[model samples]
Target: MTQDSRPRSPLAMVLLALLAEEPMHAYRMQRLIKTRRKDDVVNVARSNSVYQAIERLLRDGLIEVREKLAADTGPARIVYALTDDGRAALNRWMDAALATPAREFPEFRAVLAVVAITGPDLVADRLAERAEALAATLDVAEREERTSREWGLPRVLLLEHEHLVAVTRAELTWVRGVVDDLRSGALTWDTEEMLASRPPE
Candidate 1:
């Protein structure tokens, strides 16, 4: 099938995936995402976002309210289920997310781009500090991976964590080299020279 031209939010996909597994209310879906640590990738931090996502999904015909449950107290809760369109969209999202490299502007990369204003010495020291912290994080990830393996968690399930560890380790190695270059005067440069080298916007 051709990909839908409409935009789909990550939260919407998360909700769709949850609904595909089983019909649930927004609150329950949000809880499952957190309880399962899926929140690490999908941002279900706000209930408002979840509700908003539901509204969008409904409007787009991706999902529908399956039933309304009257609460003992407070308002009634609407249970949602995925439509056939939603299942297709969910599969599309999964395929795109897994196969495509998004053009994401991570904060660290953005900071690194403008960090030259602070001078190489300062940036190098900061990079070294970041590397040390990343090393600690890598140690934790390694331990977690070992424990997960011992617990019989399949490799497919832990691939996301493994990818994170691999990327962080590569970054740490590059940062260490940069620190050495800065300290050894191999990357010395003046602020004015840097400014002059850049074309005016």
Candidate 2:
């Protein structure tokens, strides 16, 4: 099977995750996702986002859109099914991300990509920017979540912002390590001979 085009957004990930099981239409997906989010006050997901994700996935060749047979509700709907490449990529991304506790983050892998090339100063700068951006977004999300009326929220979820905080700190610590490496001149750019002869993991 061909390797699939990588997906970046959470909605893209969610789409692939769901489509791995079976084909689904936009309407059913919206319903299931709404139920999953436990949002009852207002729709956390929009029809446009769902349709846009579908279009993007189709464009990326991760999903195939099939014309559904006529049903009681409306016009012929498009059912999305995962291609062979989609299945393979979804499994690969999941295995890589969920492998081990500390070794399982996509964000860390992304940082490592830069660290392997640009040394530490740039990595630290980028991490600082990211941390600040994520913090501000999280603050807004928390405030909105609290003031908004939503039904069937998890009892403990109201106080679960700690997870985001912890992850942010972990990333910051990694960034600090990168900065220290740069300051101490510990990063070696000469790695071709090392990698060319390295053994398999």
> In terms of TM-score, which candidate is strongest?
1
**TM-score of candidate 1 on Cα atoms, chains taken together:** 0.89
The residue-by-residue lDDT of candidate 2 on 93-144, one tens digit each, is 6564455333236775775664554535565567667667766766666565
What is candidate 1's lDDT per residue for 30-148, written digit by digit as tens? 88888777787778666688888899999989999899999999999999999998898888888887777656789998997887666887888888899899999889988888998
Off by over 4 Å in 2: 1-6, 38-44, 99-201
Q: List lDDT for all candidates, in order.
A: 0.84, 0.64
Off by over 4 Å in 1: 1-7
